[model samples]
Each structure stands twice: as C-alpha cells, then as structure tokens.
Target: MLRSVFLLTLCASVALCASEYRVKKASRASLNRLKRLINEKTEQQHSDEKKLIGVLDDSPLLVRDPTAQRHHDELAVNNLDEYFQGDVELSETQVEILEKEIVESAEDSKARRRRKVGKAPLYKRWDRTRPISYDFASSVPYSTRIKIRQAIQLWERKTCVRFQESGPNVDRLEFFDGGGCSSFVGRTGGTQGISISTPGCDVVGIISHEIGHALGIFHEQARPDQSSHITVNYRNIPIGRWNNFYPVSLSQADVFGLPYDAGSVMHYGAYGFATDPYTPTITTTDKNLQSTIGQRAGPSFLDFAAINIAYGCNQHCGYLPCRHNGYPNPNNCSECLCPDGFSGSICQYVQYTSCGAHIAVSQDSVSIYSPNHPYQFDSNSECVWLLEAPPGGKVFLEFEDVFQFGCEDTCDKSFVEVKTGPDFRVTGYRFCCSTRPTKRFQTLGNEMLVLFKGNRERSRGFKARVWSDVSPIFTTTSSTTTAATTTTTVSTTALTTVAVEESTTERLSVAVSHGVSGKEVAVKSVADAGNGSARESVSKRIANEKKNAHATSWFVLQERTF
Candidate 1:
C-alpha cells in the first residue's frame, strides 16, 4: 500500500484517486465526508487542467450533485478492505522523518532528572532465597526453566524425574550459564533475569528457585514483617531503577515468615519486583546476582530443607498452606495496579469492551511519549486509563494524528466504526511500530479505533460500546495517564431539518444534526452521523446552505438519489 495515504495528509491538499487502509467498519457518515473530499479535490484538478475559456468550454468541466455518487462512494476509498499483512510501505522522506521523531521522543520522555536520580542502589547484594512457583498461567521466566530441566537431568542420572505427576510444568523458560557473572541473589522477588539464552547461567538459578517453590518457598519480597526483609524499607520495583522507591504494601504472606533462605534461588538483587506503582524507575544500587549466588548453581541448604518439610521429595507430598488467594481477581485492584484496559485484582474485566458493562468512545490526539515506548502496545494499553472518565455516555470518534505538545511521534492510526447494536459498537484501531528501518506497524492487543453513533441496531436495553487503539508498540509498566485530557461531550438531540437550492456555487454545508452519516438524494450530499453535537453542526450547516442556494430558485433535477 502507498504510505502516501499517511503522508498525503501532511504533504498534499487532495487525497489520492483512492487509497488502502486498515479499519473495516463501513461508516456511512465518514464515507460521506470522504466522498465530498474526493469530489472537491478532483473537480478542482479537472477544472484547472481543462482551463477552456467560455463558449468552447461547453465540454463542461463539471462538479455535480453527490446523490448518484453516494452509491459510487460506497465502493470508493472507504469500502476497499484488504488484508494488511505485508509492508504498508512509506516513502524515503517519511521514513527519515519518522526515525528522527523516534529518537527525539525518547529524549523527551525520559522522566524528570529528580525522578531519574536515586535510581541506583546505595548498597545491596543478592540474598540467597528460595521461591515457590505457584505460576497460575505458568508465568515462569524463560531462563528459569532451563535450570530446572538441567537439575532434573542431573537429579535423574540415578532415577527418572517426577516433579509433577504429569510431566514437569515447563512452559517458555530460558536458561543462563554462569560465566564470569557477578550475579548475586536478592532479598525479594520482582521480575529479574539476564539476557543469556542458555540453561547453565540464566536458567539454572531459577530452576533451583522454582524447585524451592515446589518445595514451598515464598518470595523473599513477601517477608511477613517489613522489619525482617531489609534494613532499608521501600516498595517493589519491576523494571528500571527506583523500583521499591516507595513504601511497600505488605501481602499476607509477607507478614508471616514463610521461610527465610539467604542462599535460596528465589532472591533478586533488589526487592522492587512485587510492589505496586512499581518503584517508578530502576534503582542505582540494583545489581545482578554474582555467578556464585547459589553457591553451586543449585538451591542453598535451606532450600532443600524447606522443600523436605513442605513436600517430601519421595513422598509425592501435598503443598504447604497458602495464606493468600492463589488466583488474581482484576476487579478488586485499584486503577493503578491494573494493566491498560484491565481492572480488578486479576484484571479479568475488560473496561473497554463488552467484558465490562458499558463503554464510551471519544477522540483525541494520540502520539508517542518516548522513543523507548512500544507505541502500538502503548496506545492499545492507554484505554483503561480512561475507564472511569465518562462512566456512562456515548462516544464521538475523531481522526487526527498530531505529535505536538507532550506527545513525541505523529501516529499513523486508522478507524473502523462498527454498529453492533443501537448505540453499541467499536471503532477499530491498530498501532504500528516505529516507521523506521523496519517499516511495519507493530500490532499489540485488541484495541482498534474510536467510533460514535446511536444504538442503530438494538435501540433498547444494553449498549455495548467498542473502539480500537492502534498507535505504537512498547508494553511498559508505566505511563497510564496519557488519556486524561481526552474529552467526549454528549450532544443535544433536537431533530431539525433544513434544505438548500441548487443555484448556489459555493461549497454548501449540511447539518447531519443528530448522529447520522448518509447521502441526501435531494441535494447530492452525504453527512456523517456522530455525537449529537457534530451531527447537529453538520445538519444545521447543510440546512442553511440549502436555504441560501435556493434563494435563486433553480430546479435541482439531481436532488433525491445517490
């Protein structure tokens, strides 16, 4: 597809003869505007080139009523839907512009200096700690699994392994070999691992740690009492520095000395992993575990001791008691604790989709805040941030990509307006990655685009609203407030109609006054239906234009069907 579809909005005054895009929803309203746009631009081009003076110009360089063209517009730009699996190629100049924007955006998004400070840890070392793997969906690190498999092999040299009655629960774990590594175990648990793709170093420690978990070792960060885990007190940090920078919220397990193993494999260098709002950034003191963190690439003595007690190795034992609920409940959590569109403790309720009770659609400027941010994923995730904004209201979707103000990149997004029920539907969206060396829009989650229309399908009971967020692709653990500025004003629903005469030569405007996008066969025009305000504006404008055009009383032969 021609990237000009995007660059044209920037470089040219008229859209191409036609273009291919991503959204699939057939918006009768948006199509109307688009059709007019096509006509206005094309007619100007034809008239300029066919500059025939007067009498000879009877060849009639023409711009006529849109009535007949509404059906034609149906097959125009908006109806062309094809799979977007390949390169949505952009021009060389567009690529340079995009790459430059990405670098600049990164610089601007790096938090304030004060926020960046204290990111390093003062003094810390990995404390050998054993952990239990109650991985619900098997949330094990790739490296951790390697070590577990290796240990099973080592342990099985004498006998077949039986970690689980059903084969070992290894999913997508990674492995790491202990080289001249300076990795040390930490006192708590938050996600931590080396980039190594081997089982010896990266995965070894985790396997031992998870075994510790099977044997029933809780994470060090879950210290029962805040006073026991560390001399310095702070919250948990997941990524970067400053993790655990705030006061940590204690879980039930943390309050009870589940078991303390200084050399257990479960320990991370810093205790920021399990905390909320995550210690904003990485800490300065945070360091990796030394190569000898586990003493011999295995769990510490305490690890074996605890496992022996929790579940007898040869006994096929039952697990030690778990104090907290084993599963996550997305609803019980605060907005800060949840992912973009997820809420509750486990984040099962999708606030943006029908998974939630109702959804509101609105339009606003979407751009990248940081180059490091996966724009597509970030945009897709920015939804939950607005979950409670318009708790109960309709939506008005707009299409514009400007990266001024706080944003860093000009977003190349699309919209697909759906009409599932009366006022229930979603505008689809799919965000692209940096349009750079690799010119591909990286898709993240399900968010598509924003759309607004009344309950055209089922106008009575439930209103299931939907939309998409296609922007860029980093899935960060921060920046959830990018959509607070978005505003969706509900419109007035007065149904006033107006008409115009065909004698007018100026561009006549129409008021699709209510949420409506359709062609006016009587006046070769199409209008977009939307939130009451926009529709009203379109309707009133059309009405006034009709009045002025008819002041000369010319018969409009093409007034009723397009």
Candidate 2:
C-alpha cells in the first residue's frame, strides 16, 4: 500500500525550531563561479501572468519514522547506484557544480545511520517506531484552508499555470476531511473536471495549486538530500541500479529561487523525526540539493524574484508548463535532444540515470511497487500488473505522467480521462504531471494497485474506453460494482495482492466520468456491507436467507498469503 500522510499545516504558534534553508558563504561563492554557457539554448519565454499567491506550508518534507527516516538517513551518504552500471560524466566545471549540488542537496541521515547525530525527538524515537507517523491534520481547522491556498498561489506565481475547480457539478478539493487518503488536488478520471478538495468547502487559490501539480511543479523542500545540515546522512541513500528519487519533477515549475529554498512552502520542517528543529539563516546552502543544513519557513528574498518572473506583475516573462513540448532550459540541454544528460519526451532527466530501486524500465512501462500488505492473498488477490482494464474495473491510473504527458508538467485536461463498462467519457484534469523526482517526482503507473474477485475467477478481458494503466495487466477492460457490502471476497494462492493497510483507502472507478462510473456500478447486487470487525479486507456478510440457496455464484473467499 502506498503510504498516506495528513500534513498538519495547523500551527498553534510559530515553531521554535522552525528554521530556513541557509546558504553557506563558500557554497554561494561556488555557485557564482559557474560560467554561463555562451551559446546557452535560449528558451522561449511564456508571458508571466499575475501572481497567484496563496498560504503555503513552509516546512521540510522530512518526517521522523523508523522506516522512512532511516531510509532517508541511509540515502544521504549512499552511493545510490550499486546494482546497475552507468557512466558518470562531467567536465571539471560540471563535476564541480554537480558535487556542489550533491552537497547542498544532501538530505539528512536517519537516526540509525548517525554515529553522533543528535538524539531523535521525544515525540518519535527511532527505536520506538519503524515508520514515522507524525501526528497532524487532527489539529488542523477548516479555516486554515486559506493559508494552504495562499501557499499554493505563491508556488504558482513562481510557476505559471491555470488552476480551476472541478467541473460545475463536482469540486475536486475538500476543506477538512480527516480521511488519511485525502489528496489536495489531482487529475481525476471523473468527467466533471480536474478536482481539488480542501479541508473546508472552498478556497479559490486551491485551484491554482491543483493546476500547479497538473503543471508538474514540485514542492521546494522535497529536493533530494537537502537536509544534511540537520545532522542526518541522506548521502548514504543506497539505491538499486537506475535508482533516482527526488521529491519533485524537473519539468514542474520551480516555486521560486531554488536549487535551494528553505522558505519554499513545499518544504517540511526539521530533520526526519529530529525533535530539535534548527533555526536556519536567511542564506541557505548554495546547493539546493546538497546543502547539509535544514531550512526555515517563510518566503526567501529570491522567492519573490522567481515568482515575479513566473507570474506576471507589470511584466510577463516566465512559463506555464504545458503537456506538450519545450520546458525550462536552464542547462541549455534543449537542442541536444538527449543532451549531455537527460532523456524522455520533454527531457525528463535524472541525475543518477539508473533504476535499481523505485523504478526500472519494464518491457511494458516503468513499474514501481508498494510494500506488500499484511493480508495480501497470493495468487488470488496478489498484485497484478495491468496494462489496461475495462473502466470501473479494480484498478486504474490517477495521472498520465509518461504516457499522456510528453512535456513538462501539464494539466491541459486533455489527457485526464476515465471510463466504466460501455460508457466512455472524458473530462479535464486540473493539476499537473511530470517526470522530475525532485518534485516528489512520480510518474503515472509508478505505483501499483490490486483488486480481487468475490464470486468466481475469470481471466478474460473486457473493454470500452482506453485511458491509461490497468491491474495484473488483466483485460478487465469493463467491470462494474453494486455495493450492498458484508461480502467477504478473497483470492487463492494463484493470485497476489499488493497493498499495505492505510487508515483511509481509495476504491477507484474504472471509467473516466462519474456518470459512466455510476452507470458501471449500477447493478443492484454489490452493497457496502462488511464485517465491522474485519480490518484487513471488506467483509460483506450475506443475509441468512440468501445463504441457503446453494450459492449465488461459485466464488469462494479464501485467505492466502503471498
């Protein structure tokens, strides 16, 4: 199951340890030393629109958990690509810059990796917990939505893009739903439109953010290894071959002055589970990615500068990443097409070009995996790799990171699609998608979802509309659900289920628009009935009278472990 997080942007007061990303005197000097390419690839500038400033969370992405924090800590010093072989290249100048970036961008170390890092915080002790779970969202109030909205606006101003609400009938963002699985804004398969749900009923700038994600912008703080100053050693991040993971996508619009921005709203505060948050200075380490320091929250001086360029004030001169072609050519790699380093439709490049861990080049598509759930039944419910499925089937893609999107982050809304059964529909997507890992970089189909059968097992494929990814690579191109519930459906050893337990979970519709989805699940048999006690799987207990009729179908609910 892909881990879910409920970030608590609600603050009772200013955090004492709240620190900003600091720029080291030496690092800054080095950055200034870089020689600009005389014949740099000139990028066409998109007129910057008015700034869209919303309240954003000025915190670091680091959270202290046993598994997650430990993982990050190891990453700080890890070689990253031991499993795969790829040539490392750089002229002396390029090597120097790359090294500096690695230094400034280094993430903190996990408590376990530290020989003498400060002790873990009181709230979360490294030894006490495996995966860190920072308590938040509970204390968040509905009104805070405006602050988050502002943060997003500020982000969009730095990265020009259009953000709007879901279609007329539907609203993508909800104000305050404690549901752990709640996402702020995303391109939904729903026909209504790109949706953004906030904690409360409405926050206008929320659309701007949703649009930003659709544009493939990433959180400023989520940059890889930028927390070494916090005493963690993310440098040790030992990744498999082809192992590249960054918080945001390169294609996504930059929030502002970064490569290092301690004040970037997307930043999380403090080190991973580090109780004592440091107070950062106005200048963060020059290298945004390798700075061995923690950053504080708030808009930095450079922040305003970048936003001014991205979002038009009196002058329009920036960019709004579309789903087509041509993106920020900061490195002048545009003309080289597979330039010195970078590949993909719109040049989705990776610093370490190996997929030893998070992703690997699949014969189909690059496949990423979630931790196997505790109760996953092998063979029957085992996670299945799906290239396609009938709309309203068991699994589907929420975004089109690679297949649909070829350029930088784009939310043209043209690619967002969904289907269920015979009803094929299309709707606009509000947010963005990108291949950059620095921006919490994730691609569509980067994660896997699994579904199970209740009555009988059929391996046949169905179809109606073709949108994106499917599960077990099955042909369940068409399927529907009628929820009455209380039915216990399990698969046998022949099937494998992939997913970890989440406080909240999402059951997706196979179709694009909910209208088609509703129709797909129109059958009267499926009900939302399950044993209240069964935590692992949904249990729908059949009524006593119906149980006596031999059986509705020859389906057996067997529990099998993968």
The top-ranked prediction according to TM-score is: 2
TM-score of candidate 1 relative to the true fold: 0.20
Across 83-126, the per-residue lDDT of candidate 1 in tens digits comes to: 00000112233234323432343222212111100111211112
Q: Give the Å shift of residue 49 in candidate 2.
A: 48
Clashes of each: 133, 179
Model 1, residue 102: displacement in angstroms? 36
lDDT of 2: 0.24
Per-residue lDDT of 477 in model 2? 19
- Badly placed stretches (over 4 Å) of model 2 are 1-215, 221-259, 273-562
| TM-score, cand. 2 vs. native | 0.22
Model 2: how far residue 153 lies from native, Å: 6.5
Please, what are the lDDT tens digits per residue for candidate 2 over residues 212-320? 3322223334443333322222222221211222222222123332334343322332332222323221112322222212222233323333433343332322353
